[model samples]
Target: MNINDHNPLPTYHAADNRYQEMKYRRTGKSGLMLPEISLGLWHNFGHNADFTLGRKIIRRAFDLGISHFDLANNYGPPYGSAEENFGRIFKKDLLPYRDELIISSKAGWDMWPGPYGNWGSKKYLIASCDQSLKRMGLDYVDIFYHHRPDPETPLEETMGALDQLVRQGKALYVGISQYSAEETARAYSILKEMGTPLLIHQPRYSMLDRWVEGGLLDVLEEKGIGSIAFSPLEQGLLTNKYLKGIPEDSRAAKDGRYLKPDQISGDKIQMIKKLNDIAISRGQTLAQMAIAWLLKDQRITSVLVGVSRPEQLDDNVASIKNSQFSDSEITEIKTIIGA
Candidate 1:
């Protein structure tokens, strides 16, 4: 579908569906409230994928009360294609419901070649956001984030660009992803000093990955900055998809760049099997149990999940229904995963 280059903003109308069934949690101390499970266009929704089907997934997500949509400058396989594809759907269908949506885009990863292409420099961050807005066909994003920390660049300069984006009305709030506790605290202080507090912190927290529990959670709790975890399923390793070995259509088999075959060792598979057994005993699928485990932490504002098909979205959303975990189940899960 071709989105109008000069499309006008349409009137807002909330979708009439089971909106109240999905839980909405407060984003830390912020006034914004996000869906417990937010949809992200990280792996799929690219130019290489079916744009029509991608649009359907997005519409279905909104209809299911998943108002938050996450994107990045380099999300598409060819880079910038996901945002462009979403721009088409936005103008065609979602523009009218923009008021009911929380659209976010991030930068700070390698997008273009050359010196100013990557990092957290003011030039790169600001220009990247502008390019993202153009590709998204929107005036401003609800949240703009630095995808990762750049040790080469000063934190002051990086946080300054985020503050400037808010001042210019190009972004409502700012966030940082994949940053350590020290880095988050420094950036938080800098943004707060500039009078624009850091809104959210995106990390990779899953049943398999527990690095955030080290000190990141403590720092965020102290500062009142919300956290949204990406890859909460650990690139699908936390699910039954890899229990019998990698399938031909699995992410590892399709895209070896992010998840390689060698990465799935015998020990990892054994751990997965054990975890799956625990999930079965709990009367839930491994995917459901994994997502529910992350939601157990109240500090986690949302879990940003990727979906290649509609069924995957349905399965992930169903996780919320069985989020409660017994103390014994938690202990067994930790022992199985060695967490």
Candidate 2:
């Protein structure tokens, strides 16, 4: 059979064999469900990047049963370009099957220069969602999030903007990212009082980063808010691509904004080697092991990962096939990371 030849154009149906390997999990106590692994356009789906390749990655992810796609208004190096590129993909490929997907976009970072363009102020959050919807060619998003905490803005006001988004039918659910335990609790109560439950929380978590362990995880458990961890591989530090040195095609080499050369310290490299050995014992790569480790916490609803190529998506999806970690393996990982 010709790879591109088919009588009936494929729709987003579960019967598609490529989707059989994907797994879906419920988000906390909510009725919403998400794939175990969700794709994000945080790095590679910008306007300057190959748009054709971005479309391929999005379509391939859908074919492989990745239903959730996470984006933010300021994701691209040249901010807003990622959403514009995804807008093209939406019109070309995934528009017909929009109902079968959980598409989310966020605001709350430095999207533009003016006061109304940044932070968690009602003006920024509300306006950003409108711009994001326009850019993505969507009527409404499945989820809308505050990309990060805005220290200057009142938490009540920010939550009010999110609540208003739901009331206006612009977003089905709302979430917060990179918020501390205290801030999350405060926002959770405000949303709850407004009759809009906080659906999920996105945080930077990985083998090397445990900022959420002490309090944030407990708060989410108490409030029944689901979590989807971003940078689960620590911005590719957990992957073997950095085991020797930064490869030419690696994110560190391509984009130094997030993953810089200074981040690959001697101690981090040693930890990666030790963790890689442990992953080898489990018959997994360090990337796979890192993902599985994140999923071990049932409160974690999904692992939000970014991929530069199709092969990376394939490898990341394969991690779900072995999500389990034995008690001993967990303890060993803790020892290695010194958690």
Candidate 3:
């Protein structure tokens, strides 16, 4: 018997009606189904954060029907702290519900030191997946991704590493994040030849950043591969938080690691205010309307969102309630965005 087995904690019973409000979308042409709004641990769940608060946010996400949790090898400020904290939380509160969850991790960015630590070489990819599995305390991740494209590494080598992971039972599916449209097509062809089809593509998409609209969304639609939009709120700029300048506790004010203060210019603030008015007309927050805008496309499988508090999940999940937009509303939004 395990020594820690004697130390029992309070039981966590998930809500029985958790699936009633939220909708699940099929991932690409695959059998997997993910929630419309998946929880992402890119921020707020790290060694620097309070463990109890992180736990509460995670529990609340599940209670609201968020069954998928996204993570990366270098998410935390110190790197790998998010995965470590998530591993502990999983063992404590979510262990029993392992089969009900879809956990994903990536290994393409800078993780450790020296040559072998970063990039998308076969050796690096394999070793990084092993390290991530050990850290998350899981035998297999549902979807393991190459976090970014490596300029130095050949696509064949990187795609091969992902295929090998699936064959080894280390990852059920393989995905590529932030790959260009041509690169995504090449990856799909390569993975198809390898007999392990690429499952999904994660791209940074929002009203403010419309790079994906240029060609990435078209590629995903033609290839029949599911796409998840990260940074769907443009790192909180699409929300009402920046209307009166950056808040003292905002990501921009604190670290600006992702969303810098300078990025929120006067013009951006004016645009946000305009969007907020439209959101109010729809009976939704600006953040909700921003998320709903992404979900307007059928090609988008899910929108990955990060929340600092549990209450935020309730608001984010409620975006699905009014995902459909009127023709006039769309036209007005495009005019405001100058698209």
The sequence of per-residue lDDT tens digits that candidate 3 reaches over residues 1-339 is 111223444677888988899899998888999999999999887777877778888889998999999999898867888888899889889999999999999998889999999989999999988988998899999999999999989999999999999999999999999999999999999999999999999999999889989999899888889999999998889898999988898768987476776788888899899999999999999999999999999899999999998999999999999999999999999999998
Query: Could you tell me the TM-score of candidate 2?
Result: 0.93
Using TM-score as the measure, name the better of candidate 1 and candidate 3.
3
Question: What's the number of clashes in each of the models?
Answer: 0, 0, 0
In order, candidate lDDTs are 0.88, 0.88, 0.91
How do the predictions measure up, each by TM-score? Answer: 0.94, 0.93, 0.96
**Which pairs, if any, clash in model 1?**
none
lDDT at 193, model 2: 96
Record all residue pairs in model 3 with backbone atoms less than 3 Å apart, i.e. clashing: none
lDDT for model 2, on a 0 to 1 scale?
0.88
Off by over 4 Å in 2: 1-15, 253-255
Q: Any residue pairs clashing in model 2, and if so which?
A: none
Better of 1 and 3 by lDDT: 3
Instruction: Give me the overall lDDT of model 1.
Output: 0.88
Whose lDDT is greatest here? 3
- Shift of residue 199 alpha carbon in model 1, Å: 0.6
lDDT of 1 by residue, 1-339 (tens): 232234343443446984866888888799999998999999667777777677767877887789999999998877998899899888878887888889999999999999998989999999999999999899999999999999899899999999999999999999999999999999999999999989999999998889999999999999999999998888989899899888897768977676777768888899999989988987888998899899989999899899977678788888888888889988888888787
